[model samples]
Target: MAKGKVGKTVESLGDYLREQRVASRLSLRQLAELAGVSNPYLSQIERGLRKPSAEVLQQIAKALRISAEQLYIRAGILSPDDGVGGSVELAILGDTGLTERQKQSLLDVYASFLALNAVSDAEFAADGDVAAEPVATDPPADTQDQDPQKITTEG
Candidate 1:
């Protein structure tokens, strides 16, 4: 598949899955065989005729060797979380043991975190006119043998 500029706009979950399957050179029947789902079912999923449950999504993801969360993200079901935390509602939804209430709680938290982080990002940009560029950090010569940090303890 051609790499598109807008990943979010370019792919529905089904479209992404179809692309991956095609890139892997697997036919629908082959993917269904590997995924242990019916060919028709997989086809419907690719056509966006159905919304896969988390369990089904996980099964497909496993066959594709990807995280179930990634499938949901591509499907536009969940947005990524922000802040210093590498987390989002999809992380919570991926947990099979969580009750409905727990999932709601996690989603609420993630949404709030995203909102707060958006504001923080705006503030940070406003603070400096510095263009964001890759800073060249030259490693010291023969640095491989040294401990990463000379002092581990904080002052």
Candidate 2:
């Protein structure tokens, strides 16, 4: 990405973070304390003077009771498409009942399923059947010439 675009993304992320903090009714110092960061650092982040790391974003998201993926996307750390199954991941991560090992196992299985589906979709597209099939977007040429009143319903 261009330097200008990166700067804008960081600035937007900071704006978003500040909005969330305000919406959550938390003071800057309170949010900084909750996120385990210094007050000055949080202020710098809110002002778009600093681009925080993924870990810091995660901490801030947790403190704000929001999805970390949203922050990651705003921070340009992850693309929107990359967060396709984010809700599932978030659910697994947020489940306090599950042990760390169980969460990891579930995440691994989910990732494998997504990977397998992606490969299957790619293979299907590459098989030439897609190109050979007619796209059913428009009526057939014969149907286009037919009168609607003359058409019979089999049902």
**Top of the candidates by lDDT:** 2
TM-score against native, each model: 0.54, 0.54
Residue lDDT tens for model 1, 88-121: 5656777789975687677767678778988999
TM-score of 2: 0.54
Q: Please, what is the whole-model Cα lDDT of each candidate in the order they appear? A: 0.73, 0.83
Off by over 4 Å in 2: 1-3, 86-155
Report the lDDT tens digits of candidate 2 across residue range 1-155: 55687789889998999999999999999999999999999999998889886668879999999989889778765556645647776676667798767866887787788789999989998885566566567677767978988988788
